[model samples]
Target chain A: MAVLLALVVAVMLVGGGIFTLLAAVGVVRLPDVYTRMHAASKAGTVGSGLMLIAAGLHAFDFAILARAFAGFVFFILTAPVAAHLVAKAAHHAGYRLSRHATCDEMRDHTKK
Target chain B: MAAIVTGLIFAIVWAAVTGSLSPLNLVLGFLLGLFALWIIRRDFAGTRTVVRPWKLLSLLILFVKELALSAWRVAVLVASPKMDLKPGIFAFPLKVDRDIEITLLANMITLTPGTLSVDVSDDRRFLYVHALDCSDPTAVRRDIADGFERKILEALR
Candidate 1:
């Protein structure tokens, strides 16, 4: 049982670490604020959420696990809100899309 | 009726949060729940809609699936040696009008595959979404309208 629990923790930790690393890579590789927000909001959220769950499991206590779950829920619920606000602000501030962008419908709509 | 239900849910949550399921703990939780309800009742007034729990569960399942797929896709895109991304923002016409429904849809889109909701129009008629790949905006638009938007309508309305 102990071995299994340890294995689970190890897996969670490694998986979470890999995801967080990928998100960082995405932030650097992606061209602009909007695309980067995708990485920061989604991958970043899951990475941290997994680690939080792993921490809760390591304690092997029900209450701690529940609280950790609650934290994960709150984290996901708020991440997009923050990301949306930032993206909206960037757009309004005239931060242009990457040169590789295919099209921007929002820009067209605002023009009309 | 809604108030009682909300209070009960809150009480259960309180018990979980307090890390105890004892009878005393539950009663304390119930009282606290009622107190909380009293405080926030005005904010939620006149917004009670009948909730379909099963549909909501389905929505949750879909969200989980999309979340995993999104992470994998981002990881793959990020890891590839040659990045060929066409990122841009497009307007998604709003189908669900209620504040809660619109908010939920936006949040889900942000978490799902390659899509991040940037803003809502001043009139709330459209949602601006940025996609990591805008090579086929029509396909992406259809996917959201069919997938998340449809599911949200079923679950919430």
Candidate 2:
């Protein structure tokens, strides 16, 4: 049982690390702020969220697990709100989309 | 009933904060919750919504599945040699009016595949979303309508 639990923790930790690394790579590689927000908000959220859960599991205590779960929930709830606010602010600040972008309906919507 | 639900929520929060879920602590937390609710009873005002547990469960399941898929897709895109991306922001006409509903919808969209909600319009009629791949805006709109928005309506409304 202990060995199995260790294996699970190991897998979660490594998976979380890889996802986080991918998010970082995405932030650096993606062209514009909006696209980068996509990388950070979604992938980064799952990455850290998984690590939090793994930490809780490693503890092997119900209380710790509950606390970790609460942390995860709070993190998930707040991350998107922050990302949305930043995206909105950046858009309003006149940060243009990347040259590679296909279209921007937001500009059209605001024009009307 | 709203008060009972509020008390339950308080108890759970108390447990999480205290890092203990023992029965004694839970009872104490419940009593504390009742006291807190009584103090703010006027503000509470019994605002109630119908909660379908099964629908809620399904929404949660869908969110988890989407989270995983979104992460995987983004990872693959980031790792690829050539990212033939058509990133753009499109306006989604809002069907859900309530503040909570719109917030939930937006949050879910941000966490889903290739989409991040930027802002809601002044009148709350449309949500502006940034999509990593916006080659087909109609398909994306349909997916949001069918996937997260539909499930949110089922669960919350």
Candidate 3:
């Protein structure tokens, strides 16, 4: 049982670490603010959530589980909304998509 | 009010399962009790988050698939000798109006391969999303409507 629990924790930790790394790579590699925000918000939250789950699983203690869970909930709630705000602000500030970008409805105001 | 009810339920369940209300157990119960209440009341009072676990599982699988697929696509686009990309902002008309529903749709779209949820209109009638490739706006809108929003409605309702 202990071995199984350890394995589960290990997997969750590794997976979360990998996804967080992927999100970081995406942030560096992606062309523009919007895309980078995609990496930051989506992968970032999932990665953090996974790590918190691992923490919760690794320790059966209630205090640890409670703290981990609180963090998880906070992350899940705040990250996406923050991303949306950043994207919205970027749009209003006229952050154009990359050179290859094909549309800018905000610029034309036609999308409104 | 709902949270109180949920917390009490969690406390009773914890006590029952452990067969002892020791101090540690009580503390654990209290801690988890709050969490349980929060989760239980987060979406709706007197209602549940989603109706079906199987449906949520399907959604999770689909989401993971989309995540991997999109991440790969974006990575390939970035790694290619020449970048072939067409990005744009498009207004995805909102059919899901509830705050939670809209939030779910937006996050799902953002996490998927090539999109980001930017904002919703003042009236909550339109969700403005930025797509990494807006070459086919119609196709994009159709995909979102058929893909994320459809499943959200299915599980949520």
Off by more than 4 A, model 3: A1-4, A60-63, A66-70, A110-112, B1-84, B155-157
TM-score of chain B of each: 0.93, 0.88, 0.75
Output the TM-score of candidate 3: 0.69
Best by DockQ: 2
lDDT of 3 by residue, B17-121 (tens): 565657788668867999766665645664455456688779878987886576556555554566566778888889888877898898778768778888787
Report the number of the highest-lDDT candidate. Answer: 2
lDDT tens digits by residue: candidate 2, B34-139 = 9999998786465556778899999999998998999999999998988878999999998998877898999999988999999899999999999999989999
Query: Which pairs clash in model 2?
Result: none
lDDT of each: 0.90, 0.90, 0.77
- For model 2 the interface RMSD, in Å, equals 1.0
List where candidate 2 sits over 4 angstroms from the true fold. Answer: B31-47
Clashing residue pairs, backbone N/CA/C < 3 A, model 3: A101-B87
Candidate 2 on A1-112: residue-level lDDT in tens?
A: 9999999999999999999999999999999999999889888989999999999999999888888888888888998999999999999889999998888888888879
Q: Of the candidates numbered 1 and 2, which has the greater TM-score value?
A: 1
CAPRI grade of model 3:
acceptable
Ranking by TM-score: 1, 2, 3
Runs in model 1 deviating more than 4 A are none
Q: Docking quality tier of candidate 2?
A: high
